[model samples]
Target: MKIYDEKHLKNIVLLGAPKAGKTLLAEDMVFEAGIIHRRGTIEGKNTVSDFHDIEQERGNSVFASSMHTEWRDYKINIIDTPGFDDFIGEMIAAVRVADTCVMVINAQHGVEVGTELIWDYIDQFQKPVLFAVNLVDHPRSNFDSALQSLKERFGNAVVQMQYPLNQGESFNAIIDLLKMVMYKFPPEGGKPEKLPIPASEKEKADRLHNELVEKAAENDEKLMEKYFEQGTLDEDEMREGLKLGMIHHEVFPVFVTSAKKNMGTGRMMGFIDNVAPCPAEAKPELSADGQELPIDPSKPAVLFVFKTHLEPNLGRLSFFKVISGEVTTASELVNSQTGAVERIHQLFIVDGKSRNPVDRLVAGDIGATLKLKDTYTNQTLHAKGYDITVQPITFPEPRIRTAVIAFSKNDDEKIGEVLHKIHHEDPTLMVAYSKEIKQLIISGQGELHLAVCKWYLENVYKLHVDFESPRISYRETIRKSANATYRHKKQSGGAGQFGEVHMKVEPYFEGMPEPTEFPVRGKEVIDLEWGGKLVFYNCIVGGVIDARFIPSILKGVMEKMEEGPITGSYVRDVRVMVYDGKMHPVDSNDISFKIAGMMAFKDAFLRCEPQLLEPICDVEIMLPEDVMGEVMGDLQTRRSLIMGMDSKGNYQVIKAKTPLAELDRYSTTLRSLSQGRARFTQTFSEFSSVPFELQQKLSKQLQEVEAV
Candidate 1:
């Protein structure tokens, strides 16, 4: 391998819908570049990207795989990312470091649900994108329709750079519009023989070539002036203009490829190496302090870890991109977040599962290293004096959740450790123990996401587990004000305990009126642990109760608040005022007052018309318009309030607020309802009261659980 400068290095990520031939295309690229003697197929489970055991068994990419190939004096670092939304974290991490994204669209199916999903993220990162109309050799391939679809979804910026001469069953060659040459490959497909464009297709090729040149010229002033003067751009000028167009996202050149047949991949790689933006040309990354961190080898070394994978026999593999300077073996860097020093023992440029040891990784290069003591994904490693941290990737919140329990008691203790390790491998898979629900909740993008985690735990960790619907985190709150009195009397020893409490409980909100009896002896506003506030008023006048015992009384009220009086859910938004109370001279200690206070608050809470508040989430579902009615009706049954609706390309987005309890298996349900064409995202909104009809049922269930 040769040491290439950042200008000669191209970091590209292959992204698209599943079965769109992304991994296959990557395999073809590597083989064409002579990095591998033979191309590996997904079915054979020998592809470099999908090397994980789970991925091999599933026959799809479960993680992002990094591999590089030297082609035409350029080091092209290719990252093949999983198409499944469940493994979105991998796609996000890869796209974050990539200078250009090659989004592969299935010629047969065109843009799909998965394609749209990944496109949203690509747009979010604002990375330059090139489209590869792949699988053109498939029997049902429709080049015209696929091109039309791309234009419709992504606008007219999608201009053709290459087109298949004979698509589908007889797909043999592609016409390169820029050069006006035809690449005619053999039936078996390898390198192509360059020939002049056929007279029959010359007219259409000329029109497309003009469109490409015009799109390119629009990106640069010099190119625009030259195009105006000469009526067109020459080959070199067009390539330079296209590179500028791509960097500014003013043009997205679409190339044709039959990855399986190994047709047209070489031309695509040439275009990427010659036209795609390099890492230095990419937008400067911002540090945590909002300072621009450019790709400069002269600066102190700063590497950002984007992904972490736990290998079977080997330990953890941390994939990082050198943002500045260079990293070599034995380079000492400090973890930006933890401030722990890490000595780089070795540096390796990854080629699929193979680790190619390199002496140093220069700026803008992606590589992996083993066993960093205190570094993980989204963290930065920098030279000691340089206190810089790259902006972290923001992953989507987990949509589907299930309560997981160990199959055996021994496995119970190990589940936490195993889950932590799994989380390290894929951050999208989240594990949380909900003390309120008394269950360990494991959440992910969808059912398949969680299923894969379960498989890993059982097969890899030998910890069998079962999953069920998770319990919703409902809350309890009062709706009205009420007053109550309680007397605590205990006589067993020399000093008897006696205390009386008179307290008023009322619903509290910001700007609410203060209690009338307050002389302002002591005032404290305690933020509730759950989600609201507790305003405790000390209206003790005339020295009826000592002010020192006020905290003890408030403690008792909080204990009751933790376990609400109506159900066992945590309580919130209630104001308690111990306006008056009786205290015995000898026995009215903290314990007696606390007990009396607890009883009084409980009695008052019961009379105050308590209500159960379930967590509400804002859900945005994107699906084909045909299923809009069905989905909206289904949401209605879940007590959802449809906020609004909008349209995006061929899909409709329905925005609604629904209770989390109603969305237990919504991911799976939505898939089944829309035949897997619908995708959704959810975030926590405000909590709302559960309906009266469901309140009785939940109370009964709580009682049964408590009794058990």
Candidate 2:
């Protein structure tokens, strides 16, 4: 195959809500372009985009795949991304790198949350976008209602560039408003037969044509004048007017197709070839470090690594977007962050799991390279000293978390290694060992996201894992002060262990002295440092207690501070003043004073008001307006503090403060209540005093667990 430069090609991502038939459209496009031997069904697991085992078994695209095919004289790089919100990170990455975005809307379902999300992203980047109204042959498909709803919800810019010729089984032809021609299709795939509008559907065709002409006239003044003078527009003039309006965001051209039957796939390809925006066509300016960088192929190289992978077979496939300069095989690229240059050996344009070697690449191209050292997703690739890094892709923090482990326990040692591979591939999925809870917690956007990862582990890495709820990281604090004196006397045949010490324990509001507090506590609310000054005043004028044992007592106190009292949690924010004490010079050993210090700490902690602190999170929930009542009721049931409720257009946004324990699996419940329309984000807000009843329960549970 001849190498196609990025300048001649346009990359548009097919994105929408789940079950929008994006994979079927992909398969149909490949079959129509003559790139595949036969069209493959999603369930058959033979489609080009949904090739992975998990995707095939689930009948969906989990990962974004890069597919290249030609339409007309233009080269198109089509990206098919997962519609499930769990893998939304992939959709964000695709839109960031593409020149224009193609959002597919199911004719029956209308606009969904995923569609709205991608629309906002495109608006954010100021990228021109196209809308495809797909699945026209379905029984429940309503073209007029859907189109009207799109226009009402989005804007008046929605223009009917193409219309379906029939409904249900009769949906074999498409009427092109741009060319003013009817392309009819036979039962089998071939050149669609051209026919005149049937007598029964002529009135429908006339009404659609009048609406298109009026919209086109409204888009262009010249076309308006022609329409007013002649009461009609030439098909060519209307096409040009619609194209201009669409490219300028003045009009949204809606096309129709049945991807399952491969009907209208050929026409859809032609529309894309004629309308998809190349990198230069939209003239989007790339921004970095508050400066606009020109997309010059002759300039020094600048690319962004949008995705990463560490496949067992292929060590690493670092996918990147060429932003400025030309990148050819065998050349080297520098890591702008690390200042280390890596040699490029083989460049592969990835299509699903298979990769095609490309000889050379230029600006605005997306491709993959294997085994890049010191490189990961969101890293910048540029020339030496090129400090300009593309602004990172902003993603919502992972909300759901679960504790996972090796099912057989034999792969425990390899868990870390296997997770690193998964992390390299997915930046949104996070893994960490929580020392507080002693569980390996994995977090992602939702349940489907983590389920897909577990599936990947078993299928791709051949590892079985168990999933459980994550344990909370609670904290303990002391309330008051107490002083206690402890004495140790052990008589033996040779030497005797005799040590006595008296110390006063007080709350250390300022944390420890200079060593423990100043440096590490920078600006934290609590301070616990080891360099605190323990003043051993030696007030005993008679010197009953020797000074030699002071160091041992202080050391013991520090040890107790680490392995706290009441619970197995760390103790903080306290000061001990060892003003008076008596120690035997020879018999007063370190062990004797150490024991006294531990007893003193335990005594003081018990006297003080030691209370447990629970973590609270600031949560913001967004849902449709109709669900507001149920949402408020649910919040009250969860003991949530309602911050406020605001409106975003037709949607209601609820702000509240909720405990972390109550929100662990809230995403699943929210979907059930709102019919999969609600989404929320949570951030650690502050620590609050736990209720007395709850604290008592936790104390009892901790005691029982410790005893076991």
lDDT of 2 by residue, 1-708 (tens): 555555577777888888888888887786777777688887678888988767778877888888877767667777899988888889888888877677788888677666766677777776666778888888888877777767876787777767786766668887766666787878664468878877776777788788888987886888889999999998677766766676677777788878887777777677667665666666555555657765667777888898886666768888888878778776777887777788888888776677889877788777888888888887888866556777777776888899987887788767767777687668888888876577888889888899988877787778889888887766666667566777778888777887776666666554344333112211113234422222322233355555556667767876776656655555655656555556776777789888876777677667777776677899988788788888889888887999998864345789999988888788888888888877787888887677788878877877898889
Can you give the lDDT of residue 5 in candidate 2? 58
TM-score against native, each model: 0.96, 0.84
- The sequence of per-residue lDDT tens digits that candidate 1 reaches over residues 1-708 is 577778889999999978899999999999999989988888788988889888988877888999999999999999999887888998999999999999999998787778889988888878899999999999899999999989899997897999997798899989999989999999979899999999999999999899988988898998999999999999999999888878887788999999999999999999998999988888788898788888998999999999998787798899999999999997999999999999999889899989999989999999999998878888999998988989888898898889888878777868988897788667788888888878888889987798889888888777889988877788999899999999999999899998788899999999987666556677789987788999988988888888877888898899888888767889999998888989889988999888889999999999999899999999999998888888999999998999999988767899999999899889888988888878999999999989898998988887887889
List clashing residue pairs in candidate 2.
480-608, 480-609, 513-532, 516-529, 516-530, 545-582, 545-583
- Model 1 TM-score relative to the real fold: 0.96
The TM-score between candidate 2 and the true structure equals 0.84
Full-model lDDT, candidate 1: 0.89
Q: Worst lDDT window (10 residues) for model 2?
A: 517-526
- How many clashing pairs in candidate 2? 7
- The positional error of residue 5 in candidate 1, measured at the CA in angstroms, is 1.5
